[model samples]
Target: MHVRHWENSGGNIWDKYTVKMFPQEYRDIDKIYEQALLVSNYADNAIALAEKLEKAILSLEEQPYRGAERKYGFYAFKGYRQLTVENYIIIYEVFENEKVVAVVTVKYGKSEF
Candidate 1:
């Protein structure tokens, strides 16, 4: 699976935190980055996750769950879903025909609405 982030996703993630913690947060962000890398060697693990997530979404739509769930503080639009991965939540969308997932945000845990 290949993951793709929206232009401002990374910035949105960082913006939720204090500027000073950016350095330490980078260290934390590295873990997910590694998890994504382990899944696929591609330079952008976020893309990998997006692709993986798209597959899951397709499965979900095909199977038809009781309902679709949204995480707290997630803003909704026509074609996307956002969720937390540990402390940070990445916003993403699934494109059915293309089987593509686009990540729109990569924010920290302490973010508030």
Candidate 2:
């Protein structure tokens, strides 16, 4: 397969897929950070964790299908997928037409939307 986005030392990644985060996803990440702060009273650790979470999501640029289909069938879009990072689930969808993997939302793994 040919790659077109996200580069590493080995080679380029993505099947021309560009990863992007939706506004709701940003808010979800902020909520997680805020919750962490409430528990530990520190922003450093929370920030680091959030960064790592972001990296995990970016890693999906080339493997947009790495996540499984929405099992509950509650999602509006049929192409919805879920990627788990620690206790959080990153909801994303691959748009073949736009060559984009748009992160729809992020939520605690065990929680329901």
Candidate 3:
């Protein structure tokens, strides 16, 4: 999906929001997907889950404000917002000036921040 953003560093309108997934998010996704594969003994399910998650994270591109303001969070999550997919929460921060969106972490609903 295409997401409109302010002019990029080179002042190009064609540029999309820079999506950066942090190391923690990577580890979280990997752990969850691997568990799914182990439980179901089906790689397809894990693959599908990963693809679905990627799509959810990308939704921040068009409207970063779409996420609700974070309350009662740690210092680093100060300006971050969350997007939920099923039981998973995608934590991210939007750098409007640079037109970048950083996906900080993906955690389960029951987990404490």
Candidate 4:
């Protein structure tokens, strides 16, 4: 079966900051925002780091044996997968039925969780 992809329009507090200030910090943030919008225009578009984290998570989920190391609590969700992105980690579970990927949370560093 072909892998399906879906985008969500959810944003956290930190993500809000990224959205507000990234335009001032770096011009690349605009590009990042555009790329993310490709998934969902209304979705919470994050900075470069967040985009990187999402790409990594997607890669790992498609092939759970790639660079991602299986961690505990992964089984809590049917297709749970986690990955690190610039000191921050993103946890998400893949759902094959709806062709969607749901992000559970994005937190700073592994210790934050």
Question: Model 3 clash pairs?
Answer: none
lDDT of each: 0.44, 0.78, 0.74, 0.46
Ranking by TM-score: 2, 3, 4, 1
Per-residue lDDT for 60-107 in model 4, tens only? 434433334335554343455665666555555544444344455554
Q: Which regions of candidate 2 fall more than 4 Å away from where they truly are?
A: 1-6, 13-16
Q: Kindly provide the TM-score of model 3 when superposed on the true structure, using C-alpha atoms.
A: 0.75
- What stretches of model 1 exceed 4 Å from their correct place? 1-74
The digit string of per-residue lDDT tens for model 2 on 13-108 reads 435478887677778899999997888888897888799788878787767788888877366457799888888888888888887888888988
Better of 1 and 4 by lDDT: 4
TM-score of each: 0.35, 0.79, 0.75, 0.39
Candidate 2 to truth, TM: 0.79
**Residue 10 error, candidate 2, Å:** 3.7
Q: How many residue pairs clash (N, CA or C atoms closer than 3 angstroms) in each of the candidate models, in the order given? A: 8, 0, 0, 1
Q: Where in model 3 is the C-alpha error above 4 Å? A: 1-15, 73-77
Record all residue pairs in model 2 with backbone atoms less than 3 Å apart, i.e. clashing.
Answer: none
lDDT of 1 by residue, 1-113 (tens): 23322233333432221111124334445665676677677766666555544343333233322123334565554455655444455444555445344344455557663
Clash-forming residue pairs, model 1:
2-47, 2-48, 3-46, 3-47, 3-48, 4-47, 13-106, 13-107
Task: Give the winner by lDDT.
Answer: 2
Residue 46 of model 1 has an lDDT of: 64
Model 3's alpha-carbon lDDT is 0.74
